[model samples]
Target: MSHSTLKASVIISIYQDVEALHAILYALSRQIEQRFEVIIAEDCECKAVREYLAQHTFPFAINHLTQEDKGFRKTKAVNRAVAAAKTEYLMFLDGDCLPHSQYVAEHLNQRENNRVCTGRRVHLGPTMSRWFRKKPSLIKLIENRLVYTLLGLPLVFDHTKNYEIGFRSTTLHKRQAKKYLTIVGCNWSVSRADMLKINGYNEDLPGVGGEDDDLGWRFNGKGIHEKSVKFVIPVYHLHHVERRADVSTNLQIIKQNTAQKRYYCKNGVDKYLSETHEKLKSNA
Candidate 1:
């Protein structure tokens, strides 16, 4: 199908965040009008999630895929789901996120001719429940989403700053520019053609470190500049406890790849997926 005619595909990578997964799925079910497919990539081979997915029916088709226990790292699992996405436009989010009602609709409405559109995210505290308090109109939700990070920080119901601190900046509210670089994987989308040009997510990324940064840098290198999706497409980040250890080692790989163009692209993801597929198949 042509890029314009293609449906949007949302890819979410989860590892043991069952509570967050529940909220994410629930929010997606209540979305206003939109055309999209949801892919839930469970990084670990857990029966609880598979069982939950099997029992709950979503408004849209949900494809649930599991990988053999790959520790807690997220890069590999994310790429696994991306490989299976059929839509030309792809959005990536963590399982702990609650998208506003217009999340999907606004994303579809703001396509800038193959440009990668990134949205503004609010950090919701664990104390605050993100469940359905009331049904929201599409326009109101979109307007809220457009609010920039710094401006929305004070008003966020959650009051937790963990996720917000990393993103709050007046610069984020502006349009695309030469040195612009802010890539939060949680609410980012790009055309399929653009992803293929960058060879998709780097599977060899040892850990979480530079995967998001690499994608943003590569996109900029290819002349597809990044732009903040105005606060109109606001999403609530489901609260969660801190994660152990830092995944910065992968950031080094990102730097290495940047200096040497098409490193992961040259290696290709087919072998990595084939190996992962065989590993999971053997476990089965």
Candidate 2:
């Protein structure tokens, strides 16, 4: 599809979780809005991921982009995806997060210039995760979200947290003050131009907990506001063991960058611009 025709480029950051990745793809397939393409930005070029994509049939066009398996370089992987986006708007999703059927529709509907839309996810516990692992179906989850999440709440193994977001009620979509909302990388959409204004995700951060936050803060610095679509664009997060990265190092860097109001990050999509220029020059 042409840039103007595509609603958004859904860029998903993933690594080695083929099961969860497939679940995410299936969820995207069921989105009410299907005028977008999927970009699988894997941190590592895994064989299983390639094999699965090779075998699977998806409704929307899907492209797989991967980097060498370097440790915890999600920011880099996502940035690469951003560089390759074929649309004007960009939606980000983690491999383990499944967007609601209306997720893409709402996100595309909620788009505004100089504003970033961020949404929250319902954490699926082991029970639902296992249920999904057995057979991942976005439609089934949507159909039984209330009951399944409610049932999971009683048992400790079914550690479903903040599941209220999973419930799709017009009353519960309490959008925060536009300027103060937090950006959840897994479920956020921003104009590609707005993102590139700040040079996209800060690759220098080197880990989670800071890169997305820093991206939002930088957007704020550039006068772009954060608009929360919390309940309106719900995503169901599949369970997985957390990967811990060194926080102190990334934290210190974030503090310095924030204090400096460095909206255009040093290590980000700017590198791609340089690389592309060099390639074009060589071809010329």
Candidate 3:
């Protein structure tokens, strides 16, 4: 797919949540900065999601990619999306999480040549999740963040944690100089040129839980360590059930990788890179 000149790409990893994806897209369209494209990296090719995407349009370009639904292969799914990304700079967001209005702008502002930027999220509980499911007005949530944060503090929304991360301000937007920053896949950004050097996500990872930590580990080995943007960029995570089926395997793989000091894994985005992509890398 040909792309226009874009400042960055927002690659969203999703399953069969077209409704939540709609709200996500709505939030992306209203970002304070508007120079990025979106890529939907779906783990399965569900017909409903395809139909919904075909019917809707956003201000920025949108592309969707899907693989056969075998099981929890988020590594394979997102690696493919990263290989398909048009810009050198990009971010990863879960389908259920909504980015703050200044999310992209702040990320762009703080991007360093050889470092990845990672931040935290505000996890919403059942009550607020139900309210947003009925009417997902992300703008309303941001505008009245104090009211919502107070409600969440009292447990009125069940277990909506991380209220401190919800607030955004230029005063607090400074990146931490920490050398080893643990990551959450839902709110992170890295350069395509740098990520390809360590090979994207380790496709050898079996499940969802520890890929971020694994990636951060490898990034440090490759001299592309992480910088903290904790109190800087905020994302609201809609509630969802926990998925821990094959998470044990991920932890095992991470342990093995760290023990062996494996910076570049045998399986990753390299397998999915096309000839055009190779030339793109070579030219870089």
Candidate 4:
């Protein structure tokens, strides 16, 4: 990679999880020799998260922003954040996620033409065994669905092991790219150009559930394959409070898009970004 390519940016979508945001920021600060800008898009209606990020000194300069008063869906906040990114490469990490030290370097190394790279997610809270012993209600499921149109899986009966089934590693390597059925927006990296092509994520996604799946569908349709980085770079998912369902219809949208390959094609996000340079200027 050239010096130009080394210029990358990290984009994170945040709502009200101050604790998770702090953890993510600390993990990112440990990277000793890299230079990249981190943009945090606070989608929540509150100012607490913004205040916290402002008070801290991160390893890299941090750009913090907020959207107009809107509900807590992640898509709007993230899009606003990406529009402000100042790098050739864009890495999306969830506020609740703890990336390994080599996370950014690993993704930068794996980047290739028309490709989106995603890594594995490991649960970081009490063992699955413990979860079953203290089975919590599906409060999270309901909140996620009703509040954000997102979905959370039922607690596994066994907690001794990681929730391996929830997040299986991708097997693809850097050189070869192939279409994928889905890509997790969190812990995934793609050129800012590629993202805008799919309209910077379906703002009309109806909820939080299928935004990633929708992006995967759009990429596959556009011939942009998904590559897994799990065998190499792994992320720890800090256990947190379950979310209430704000909406559940978006999952169905993803299912339909995946089945139909709704946005699969050759020309995609790259073209979109190029055309909308003025609109998404910051990310470029």
* TM-score for each predicted model, relative to the true structure: 0.77, 0.91, 0.90, 0.71
How many Å off is the CA of 120 in candidate 1?
A: 2.4
lDDT of 3 by residue, 83-201 (tens): 88888898989888988888899899989988899888988887776677667774465546576556654544378778767777555655454534587888999999989988899
Q: Write down the RMSD of all candidates, one decimal each.
A: 5.9, 2.6, 3.3, 9.4
Please provide, for model 1 over 6-95, each residue's C-alpha lDDT reduced to its tens digit, 9 standing for 90 to 100. 478888888866666776777777778456888888888778888778788777778787888866657667766776676877887877
RMSD versus native structure for model 1 = 5.9
In what order do the candidates fall by TM-score, top score first?
2, 3, 1, 4
Question: Tens digits of per-residue lDDT for model 4 on 178-265?
Answer: 4332577568999887776665666656555666767777776777778766545656565656653534677776676667766742
Deviation of model 3 at 8, angstroms: 0.3
TM-score of 2: 0.91
- Which rank order by lDDT, best down to worst? 3, 2, 1, 4
User: What is the alpha-carbon lDDT for the whole of candidate 4?
Assistant: 0.63
Q: Which stretches of candidate 4 lie over 4 Å from their true place?
A: 1-6, 126-181, 244-247, 254-284
Per-residue error (Å), model 4, residue 253: 3.6
Q: Model 2 misses residue 118 by how many Å?
A: 0.9
lDDT of 2 by residue, 1-284 (tens): 56577888999999899988878887788888899989898999899999999997888888799889978889888888888777889999988888888888998899999999988887888777877766876346454656655565453456778857766766666544343568887899999999999999888886667777788789999999988787678887888888767787888998998788788988899787666567658999
Q: Give the TM-score of candidate 1.
A: 0.77
Lowest summed lDDT across 10 adjacent residues in model 2 is found at: 148-157
Candidate 2 error regions (>4 Å): 1-4, 138-157, 175-179, 274-284
Clashes of 4: 26
Cα lDDT for residue 124, model 2? Answer: 81
